[model samples]
Target: MSSITVATWEQLASAFYQHGWVWLPHFLSPALIAALCDDLQQQQLRSAGVGRQQDHLQNQQIRRDQTAWLDGSSSAQQDYLQLMQQLQQAFNQRFFLGLFDYECHYARYQQGDFYQKHLDAFRGRSNRVLTTVTYLNTPESGGELVLYDEQDQLLQRLPPAAGGLILFESERFPHEVLPATSERLSIAGWFRRNNSLQGMVDPGT
Candidate 1:
């Protein structure tokens, strides 16, 4: 990926703060996108789970995307992580969000798979503060991200275009993935604050 400048980071923060979500279609370099795509194909993906910790379960009616966590085991993954770290710091500096860490995973949606509208975080029950998605491959049709406003009204329908990045406030908006007519690949991630119960940190999924 190309070098991410401080100005670019500021722009991302400003846009996200004002609009509640930001979509950048040319955020990543082509080489990096290709490398991540290749890595996703080699990884073993499992049915995506809903809810958190003990409440987690796979409900196909609500979601059918498969996923594999990005463990920073490869160069491409490490690079991506570095980019997120920069964003995390930028967020803290500009918004005083106190974001502690970021976690992301590869998501694969096969033909006919979809996820119903849902919020990534509750108002105070979770640590996830912001959501991020980067598309690795482009599908000919379908597989759009439908984001909703606070009142559950339509906000935007984002297509899964390669090299595109989507950022949104986790608790403020509800979103869903439409069924794909072909295989769709992307990375879904979250920026988290340290929300611990007793001494244990909240587990994010």
Candidate 2:
């Protein structure tokens, strides 16, 4: 990747350690990012969760997010699998096991679309440890991924760029997609560990 460097990754991870998140600009190679973006545009999408804010703000509509883990489509699934295998070879790769279930979502924020600040994990489901987002198509205006700490201090900003990817601990401090003046496209998912503690859902709650 032209924009992703180990030095950059190190920088990103370092920031994540200190503040709980980092915007690793252009982590994926350009060609791979392009392919993934094209594939995502064609994939099915859905609202991230309940989709309603306390004050009636609606989250972005992902009418075309692909559920690669469950889909019968083999091409993209195979591609993701291959990428995981390659990532395994890298020394800096953290998760010892392959990725758990994942999703590729296409997000288009109309002029008024917004997502409330929230953590990615749930109360009674399988826990997702690491949350990673890859920017596929970023509009010229708005749509910033704001990183916050447990103290609710805004740490840094990650403007959108195709081929840009950001990774961080999902179970840590809360994060969110800021309201966008235009449209935004991204793929967000998690990488699981080999030994996921069973019954963590209830206990963690």
Candidate 3:
């Protein structure tokens, strides 16, 4: 996989600082996307849960997608992780975000599936600071990611485009995945700060 250029990283930082979000088209190489998608076909996905671990539960009424967490168990996953490490470094240098870790999962939305508007993390509750979604397949219909502003007003509605990336402040944006009329695939991830309690770091999901 090729490296994410310094100019691109600068643009990402500038957009995040100014707009609370940034959309980067073609963020991932086509080869990596293809390899990841191919790998996804062999994995078993379970009903995606809402809320953090322990608080986590499957609530189809709120979210209907299925997911599989990435465990750095594959070459494709490791390549993606290395790229994210570079991004984390760039973000820290440009914005001083103090992001210490990253976690991601493969998400799939079949026909009629949707995830209702929600926040990735709540203030004073979790360590997740940024959300990143990398679209892998372009569906024929629906599967749009709708983002809302602080006042709950619609900000942007985006359709899935392979190789595109949707990034935003996890706590600042209220977003939802619209019902998909066809199958959709994406990798969803978060950048986190260490929220250690006493001597143990909080278990983030």
Candidate 4:
């Protein structure tokens, strides 16, 4: 990926502050996106679940995508993680968001697959502060991401575009993935604050 300049960071921070969300086109390099796409194809994926931990269970009515958590096991994964780490730092520095870490997973939405509208985090329930999605492949049609505002008003409808990224406040927006006519590939991630109790660190999903 290319280095993000200070001016670019300022623009991103400003846009996020004003809108609580931002869409960046070609935010990642094509080579990196290609590498990540290749890595995703090689991984073993499973039916995606809703909620977290024990509450997590597959519900086809709500979602029908397959996913695999990224582990930084390959060079491509490592590079992607490093870029996100820098992004986390940038957010913290600009917004004082106190982001402690990030976690992401490769998501594949095949034909007929969709995820119903939902918030990524609930107030006082989850540590996830920010949500991110970076597209790896561009589908000709279908699989658009629809984002809604606090009043449930339509905000934006984003189509898949390789290297494009969308970022938003996790708890403030409700979003969904539309059924795909073709395959849609992307990385879904969250920036979280440390919500550990006593001395134990909170477990990641």
Candidate 5:
């Protein structure tokens, strides 16, 4: 959190309040970014699925990328998680979001890979309150994240760049990853609220 000063938090807060989403360039330190990039390359990734848990299944027509969940098994991962924890605290203090925890996974897209427009969460049906993404490698071309409003109107097309971070309301924006001309790497994460009941903690996927 020391890496992200109070002024930086204020800027993030202001931007998030003004819009449903915000993008911050060079959000991660170069050393951390390099470490994450190396870590991702060593992971065993599987074809990404479309849905969650029981309903989860591969659908290449919808998305063409590979993924591996992060478990804080390495120093780079632990550091990244700590930063996110600080961010969660900041959001809770500023917006009263009641975020309970964070979950993330490394995603890799090779040439021609893409994910079609989709919503990260559904209102009243999901505990995920916010979506976050940090790019690990900047592809020479393609692989932009395109966001759309509730009315299906285009909002922004963001290019993937190392150390860049993006945050948006999970259920409010429909977004997609354009096909990559080269390889692309990134971490996709979510800030989730607890939805446990009857003494059982809700499972996060």
Candidate 6:
């Protein structure tokens, strides 16, 4: 994979702060990301849910705990190290104070599997700043990301695309995945700042 250039990182932060979300194009190349996904070994799809969701979809989640580069190893551990370096630099600016944690994830939404609308960060674990999901495989049909507007209208649709990512605010918006006709593969986790960074000063200012 080619090194991530600075301009891309700048754009990512800019988009993130503005819309409370951002879609970095080809953020991680498919082949490299895919190879990593294939190498992931899991004990079983364990239950790690905290809220209730509409039935008709099966959900599975696995968490990878890593404090730093050498703290752990996975198919994508090193790659995630690179990811953290860029994220640390990008989020260290004045306005954003959300702390970053290393809990890499593997999520599969298989046939009839769906996640109901919900936010990742709540009052107790209010540190979840951004919800990040990197697509490993796009389904043959169905399984589009559904994000809601303030009025709770289904505002946008994200067709699954390998290497494609959907990042959004953990508090500002509610998101869900529609039930899939086929299998959906993805990697998702959160990056929290040291503090909530509720009121931030624009570094540009």
TM-score, prediction 3:
0.97
Q: With candidate 2 superimposed using the best TM-score fit, by how many Å does residue 153's alpha carbon deviate from the native?
A: 1.2
In model 5, residue pairs whose N, Cα or C atoms come closer than 3 Å (at least 3 residues apart or on different chains), thus clashing, are: none
- Candidate 6 lDDT for residue 103: 46
Ranking by lDDT: 4, 5, 3, 1, 6, 2
Compared with the true structure, model 4 gives a TM-score of: 0.98
> Over the full model, what C-alpha lDDT does candidate 2 score relative to the true structure?
0.58
User: Model 4's lDDT to the true fold?
Assistant: 0.94
lDDT per residue as tens, model 3, 1-205 = 6578977887888899899899998899999999999889888999999988778899999999999998888888898888888998888888899999999999999999999999998888778999999999999889999999989999999999999998999999999999999999999999999988788976657
Expressed as tens digits, the lDDT of each residue in 92-199 for candidate 2 is: 354233444443344555565666677765444345566777777768977788878767898667888876777777766577677777767676656554334584
What's the TM-score of every candidate structure?
A: 0.95, 0.67, 0.97, 0.98, 0.98, 0.75
What CA root-mean-square deviation does each model show from the true structure? 1.4, 6.1, 0.9, 0.9, 1.0, 7.7
Q: Where's the lowest-lDDT run of ten residues in candidate 3? A: 196-205
| lDDT digits (tens) for residues 1-205 of candidate 5 | 2267888788899999999899998799889998999898889999999988899999999999999999999988999999999999999999999999999999999999999999999999999999999999899999999999999999999999999999999999999999999999999999999999998888888
Clashing pairs in 1: none
* Model 3 segments more than 4 A misplaced: none
Higher-scoring candidate on TM-score, 1 or 6: 1
